[model samples]
Target: MNGPGPWGPAVDAQGAQDVLVHQALMYGSRHEYLLTAVPYLRAGRRAGDAVVVLVEPPVAAALRGQLGRETAAEIEFLDAAQWSRGPMHALASCHDRARADWWPRGRLRLLAEPVWRGRTPLETREWKRHDALLNVVFAGTPTMIMCAYDTAVLPGHVLDAAARTHPELAGPDGPAAAARYTAPAEFCAECDAGPLPPPPAVAARRSFATGGLPGLRSFLFTEAARLGLPEDRTLPFVLAVNEVATGIIRDGGGRGSLRVWAEAGELICDVADPVRVLADRFLGYEPPGAKGHDAAMWAVRRLCHIVETRSGPQGTQVRMRVRIG
Candidate 1:
């Protein structure tokens, strides 16, 4: 019963060594959700694993109510909003928790409920990429993530994607293999398949050489401010721009082009270098470890509201966005 399956992994057909057990669960109501969560947590407790539930307040209360005082108190109730700040940070937080808080003691049983109600299409796509990355992020760790979706509120596309993102599907009866599950790398690549639109004709654009880098930051700050970035956002926005600009100087050759604009009430900036090629898709996905593009990008993702990076035959380009209001 305790092996590579339902709440575990089947990485390969030969029963590949187990690592992360990633599954999706769809429920239309509180009762439906608890039908799987309650028993899942209880089983984790019985097996001596570290159990954690990340859900909304009302839903958490429902789960708590079902378990009574003692059982509810044993599991950690995490705020989904806080735990899912952004892709890089969320992955780092999950990795850190598994390593620091639970890995050695026992397996981790996480009932994850990410808030997706108000997310823009762009934001939702990025989160889906994060979900795909989860399979590999905890590659060798003993972790079971029950990613939850509310069938009533979420659109069909959102619920449909869960099937592709998770390796298995969790239901009241048990777990079943997710036939539509896409491999992490392929799934992430699919997310980036569409080319980002070019900056509008009215966009403020500039070309910078290695030495003109100082002026690049100045140009960026000035444009961002004039375009509607608040006083508080200008500095971080500049920092994010400089990180990409300098990174190009250090690694992507000595020159690149810059474009700035405002659209749909958000400030957008693009930095491009024809000579740079990215070899690692996860360069900045993890916590900043050492000095390199990885570290530079980690800062870029943190500073900007939403960042999209593309590198290939078209060259490498990084687009950073921050809401104007």
Candidate 2:
């Protein structure tokens, strides 16, 4: 509306672009938000792109009320704030949508508000990591994603990270390339650099090798239940731990260690194997067949409340936590 946004010039039939336009909209009020989102969606409608609005109810209501029923009728609105399950879940869903729906249409234009009101510092960091990885994950895909952040509520650091994570910044005037943008790979690594705090001393530890998975599962499952882990999560928790352990036996030096413990109202199980460099950055986030057992990571991430993965000289560690509350 004001000037050409990150979506670039007008697109017509057979004139779709191949670029990925990812922008961060820092808005403090309703008016500031409408300035960028309204015109952006209108343009997407004009270009025949699949326009999706994924935001909280209030924001969606505002858009529907402002755009009028006729104009908003064509768009798909999802009542979700912050991704549905988690960032990884959101990543896979977007990829699936883009792959399934991008060709017939020109591209997918998405606008969503990321939730940050009650996240811990570590959780917030992971979201930022996910944001940086978006550029890497969606490379060459025909999609435009704009994530809106509430300036009044978000911490200064989080707002700054928005700029670093997104390649461009969406504003009332228009979009501009972000000067503070960090390359996806570099930023992701930065988010993962810190060493995970050592597992608790009271953790039940067992070392296992080939053909010992049954025993490992028995040990993990027993300990998980004894620790008062919810019955619903205990089985999945054991199965996820088994998956990692089985992988270690088959591919990671034929042996590994399992540690299960309770810490800060959470049940944490960690699987550690010999230091093996796993190359795929989007290992668990990609759709099936993208990487060998990539979907394994996808499952593991979803099955647990939180997962922390790290590889270094110490070894490769995948720690999954399930909330006891």
- Predicted model with the maximum lDDT: 1
Question: Relative to the unseen true structure, what is the C-alpha lDDT of residue 197 in candidate 1, on a scale of 0 to 100?
Answer: 93
Regions more than 4 Å wrong, model 1 = 1-18, 97-105, 288-293
> What is candidate 2's CA lDDT for residue 137?
69
Best by TM-score: 2
Cα lDDT over the full model 1: 0.81
| Deviating ranges (above 4 Å) for candidate 2 | 1-16, 82-84, 100-106, 290-293
- lDDT of each residue in 1-325, candidate 2, tens digit only: 2225445433334554666778999999899888888888888887678899989888999999888898799998887654655566676666776677754576788898867767777678877887887787676667788999989788999999999999889988677879999987787777778778898889999999988988888898889888999888888888888888877887789998878899877899888887576665555655565435466777777677667788877778888888777
Taking all chains together, each candidate's TM-score versus the true structure is 0.87, 0.89
Task: Give the root-mean-square deviation of each candidate in angstroms.
Answer: 3.2, 3.0
* Local accuracy of candidate 1 as per-residue lDDT tens digits, 163-197: 99998888887888899998888877888787799
**What TM-score does structure 2 among the candidates reach?**
0.89
- Report the C-alpha displacement of residue 130, candidate 1, in angstroms: 1.5
